[model samples]
Target: MTSRCILQTALLVYFSTTVLAVNYDLLRFQLSSSSVECQNLLLQLNGTTKDCIKDRMNFKFPEEIEKPQQVQKEALLLVTLDIFQKTSDIFRKNLSSTGWNEIIVNNLLEKIHWQIEHLEEILEKIKEEENFTWDDRTLLPLKRYYLRIVRYLKAKVYSICAWKIVRAEMLRSFFFLDKFTNYLPN
Candidate 1:
């Protein structure tokens, strides 16, 4: 029957769509793996939580980044912590030499929990008020700064750990590394 034919066609379309949706992330991972920059960026973004978990669990840095730059590694770890705090989900995996990942994961989760509470308070306050005093002028700067934060964070990820090789002087500026910015005389 015609009705049966329509149902079959619809079902076929739906099946294909759902299958693609499920594999979207896997496709992203696969495509990204082909390129060095893409892989590193993915690693930087995903590795934030992974590395932090490793750090907390006493996971040692991968031999790749565990070179003699002790100061560089420590400073970069601070940067790593900041980015990790901004993003991470449950079901974390360890990527370190030690098992200190649990402690840091707990800490990161606690911070996220508190942030949700704070957001709730803000939402409640917004509902109670019709308009914020000086809202237009005051909120614009905040919005700009928030956008800047996003770019700064991305730049840090790409230029640092994500890149095959990134320079300290270059990264120093992202975190306000003023010392490296000093002008030199010829």
Candidate 2:
């Protein structure tokens, strides 16, 4: 046993720098050497090699699964944002017309509801996962969120402008009431 330990120690010193040199062929040769302890040690080393391989494989598989999950989530958000931008263009075109006000308001409200729901869902997912996954797809969700925010602000501005016009018309109509009532032919 002492001689076997000495032999293994000497081999370790010789091969210390070469991590890849521990192969089946080299191990088989060592196992067949005269020392019983060397043979047992070679079997134990084989188990360690298997464990190292398993750790590497386990490390790579999750990355493969996680990457595409990120892409899928991000693509959904990007497409949702794009649809919003196009829908915004329509709202922008129609904002000046009284005829489109009710329909646009309804549509804008629905879009707001959707954005809120999606944003909540996204936030919930992030909270739930919390560093379990990372993806390039995140850019799209964040961008979509930006688009929705812009849409919301634009809608509010249009509503304000439309209300201002209505308020001006009401003021003009009332402006004559006091003067006309007081100047009634006596």
Candidate 3:
């Protein structure tokens, strides 16, 4: 009876430990997902500006920015900030062109800045729930919330690009009309 009880107790301990084991895969997945999300956001923004301004502006997104895997595990925040800085620099350079209107450029910058902030917040949320299992009911809400934030950023970028194109067309028309008027007999 004593041996049987000891075996049962040992099995119980083992099962409990397994049940409480940390899921490192989930943590790594979160990190990877966040990194990709950030990269996608920057790339989309780059594409938007490029499409809006076309050959009227010269710009390129930095394609070699470091990924999350390259970041030191202990310095996640610092590396993440570095990533944002590089992307932000690209954005500023693109918008500072003399061709783009100041008001539209400022609006674009503000949208990107807020998007970056939101991305950082999402990363924090992921980190806080690193130990959660994939099947956890809590994870569903978390993923849904994060997806909504991503969609919001994407929509804002699209809107800014659309507006830029329209504004550019209006300015061009005004300039052309002004030139035509100048050529008229007066």
The model with the greatest lDDT is 3
> All candidates' lDDT scores?
0.32, 0.36, 0.40
Winner on TM-score (1 vs 3): 3
Q: Give all candidate RMSDs, comma-separated.
A: 21.4, 34.4, 19.5
Model 1: per-residue Cα lDDT at residue 127: 39
Q: Estimate, for each residue in 127-151, the C-alpha lDDT of model 3 and write its tens digit.
A: 5545422223322332343244334
lDDT of 1 at 75: 29
- Estimate, for each residue in 4-88, the C-alpha lDDT of model 1 and write its tens digit: 9999999999987565332324422322222223223233332333333321221122222223233232222222222223333
Locate the minimum summed-lDDT window of 10 residues in model 1. 177-186
TM-score to native of every candidate shown: 0.25, 0.25, 0.28
lDDT by residue for model 2 (1-186), tens: 999999999899777634423232442232223123212322222112232332221111122122333335323333333333433343344445333345535545454345445534543554454433434454444344435534443555544343333223222222322122222111
**After superposition, which runs of candidate 2 have C-alpha atoms over 4 Å from their true positions?**
1-74, 85-94, 101-104, 130-186
Per-residue error for 175 in candidate 2, Å, reads 49
lDDT of 3: 0.40
